[model samples]
Target: MRVTVIGAGAVGGALAALLDRAGHEVSVTARGDHAVALTESGLTLDGGFGAHRAGVAVVARVPADTRLVIVATKANDTAAALAGVDVPSGCPVMVLQNGLGGDELVRSVLPGSPVGVGLALFAASLVGPGRVTVTAAAPLVIGGDARSVAVALPVLRAALPERVDVSADIRGAQWTKLVINQVNALPAITGLSVQQTVADDRLRRVLGAAMAETVAVGAALGVSWQAIGPVDAAALRPLQAPGAEGVAAGEELARMLARGMGDVPNPASMLQSIRRGRVTEVDQINGAVAAAGRAAGVATPVSDAIIALVHEVERTAAFVTPADAATRVSTTQD
Candidate 1:
C-alpha cells in the first residue's frame, strides 16, 4: 500500500512509522523543523511499543499515486492540511481527528472518493522533532462506506498495534468519541493531566455536567450514541439526572477515566497544545457541545464557561492558571 499521512504530528507520525515498519511504502507530510528532521533522519516512535525507526519519504506536498490518504491534522487545521493535497479521485481518504465534521470536509474536498472517519482511541504525543511517544494503546475505529472500509481495514490493522473495528454506524461512534473528548478541555483549562483532573471531585462534577449536556444535545440531534472502545455512551446517561444517581454517575466516570489512564500519565492533546503556545481545539471539542446544546434548546452553562476560559487563556497567552480556570468554571455552575 502506498500511504500518505498528512500532518506528521503525534498521531500521523506514529502511524507512518508503524505502517512503514509493516512493509508499506509510507510517505508523511510535515512542516518546518519536523519535516526537515523526518527527511534527514526518518521517524522515531518510543514508549510501550519500544523504540523503532523507519525510513519513509517525507514531503511538503502529497505525492502522486497515493493509495491511502490519512488526514491526521488537528481539527482546526484540517482545511489547510488538505488544501495542498491533490487526492486521486476514488482513492480512500480516512479522517483521524477529534470531534465532528472532519469526514464531511474530506468528502467535500475529494468528491467521488470514499471517505472513512476514524476515532483514534489512543494517546500519543510529539516528544520532539521527528519523534513521537505512544503512551497508551486502544482500538482505532474506522467507519464509512463498505468500499472504503475494505480499502482501509487490512492495511490499518497491519500497521497499528491496536485492533481495528469497522463500524456500521460511524456517526454514532463519532458521537461517542466526542462525549469522551469533553474532558480534554478541562485539562487544558486547569493545567492538569487528565488523570489529575478526573480524580478531583469538584472537577469531575463539572466534567460530568458538561458531558451530560453533550448527551442531551446528541439526543436532540437524533444521534444514537454508541460505545467507542470501552466507553459506553448509554451508560453515561445517568450523569444527567439529579440527586444520588448523578453522584454515582460522576464516580463511575472518574473510575473509567482512571482505568483509561492506566500507567501512562499522558496529558490531553489540548493541554499539550496550550503548552506549545498553539491554539487549543476547544472550539471543536467543548465548543461543539455548546453549539449543539443551543440548537437543541438545552442549557450548556458548564461547556460555555469552559469555552470562554480556554479562549481567554489562549488570548492572554495562558495568563490564567488551571486553578483560576477551575474557579471560574465552578462559579458558572452556580
Candidate 2:
C-alpha cells in the first residue's frame, strides 16, 4: 500500500514509521526542521511500539501514485492541511485526529474522495522534529461510510500493529474519545504529565468535573457510546451518577486512561502544542463540548473553565499551578 500521511507530526509520523516497518510504501508531508530530519535520518519511533525507523519519502505534496491517504493533522489544522491537495482517484482518505468536525471538513474540501475518521486509542508524543515516542498503545478505531471502510480497512489493518478496529457507530466512538480527552486540559494547564495530574487530589476532582460535564453533553446529544480501548459505555455511566458517586466514577475513568499510558510521562497532545508555542485544539475539544452543552441546555462550567485556562496558557506561555487550576474550576462550579 502506498500511504501518504499529511501533517507528519506525532500521530502522523508514528503511523508512517509503522507502515514503513510493515514493508509498505509510505510518504509523509512535513515542514521545516521536521521535514529535514525525516529526509536526513528517517522517521524514528520508540517506546510502546518498540524502536523502529523507516526511511519514508518526505514530501511537500501528496504523490500522484498514493494508494491511501491519512490526514493526521490537529483538528484546527485539518482544513489548511488538506487545502490545495489533490488526492488520487479511488483512494480513500482517513482523517485521524483529535476532537470533532474533521471528517466533515475534509469531505467539504475534497468532495471527490471518500472520507473516514479514526480515533487513536494509543497516545504518542512528537519528542522532536522527526522523532515520535509512543507513550501508550492501543488500536486505531476507524469508521465512516461503508465504501470507504471496505477500501481502507484491510490495508490499514495489515499495516498497523495491535488491532486496527472499525466502529459501526463512529460518532459514538468520537464521543468516547472526547470523553477520554478530558484528561488533556488539566495536564496542559498545570504543565504536568497525565499521571501526575490524576494523582493530585484537587486536580483529580477538577478533571472528574470536566469529564462529567463532557459526558452530560454527550448524553444530551444522545450518544450511543462506543468503547475506546478499555473505556466502554458502561464504565462511563457512573459518571452521570448524582453528586459524590459521579465525581468518584469520573476520577476512576481518569485513572483507567492513565493506566493505559503505562509509566511513561505522557504529556498529552495539548500540552505538547503549548510547550512548542503552537495553537491548540481546545476550541474543538473542550469548547466543542461547552457549545453543545449550551445548545442542549446543560451547564458545562468545568469544561468552560478549562477551555479558558487553556487559552490563557496559550496566550501567556505559562502554566498555572494545580492549586490555581483547581480553584478556578471549583469557583466556576460554585
Global Cα RMSD, each model: 1.7, 1.1
Residue-level lDDT tens digits of model 2 in 115-179: 88889888899999789998887889999977778777888787677798889999999999999
Which stretches of candidate 2 lie above 4 Å from their native place?
none
* Deviation of model 2 at 325, angstroms: 0.4
Indicate which candidate wins on TM-score: 2
Count of backbone clashes, every candidate in sequence? 1, 0
Collision pairs in model 1: 190-322
Off by over 4 Å in 1: 319-322
Taking all chains together, each candidate's TM-score versus the true structure is 0.94, 0.97
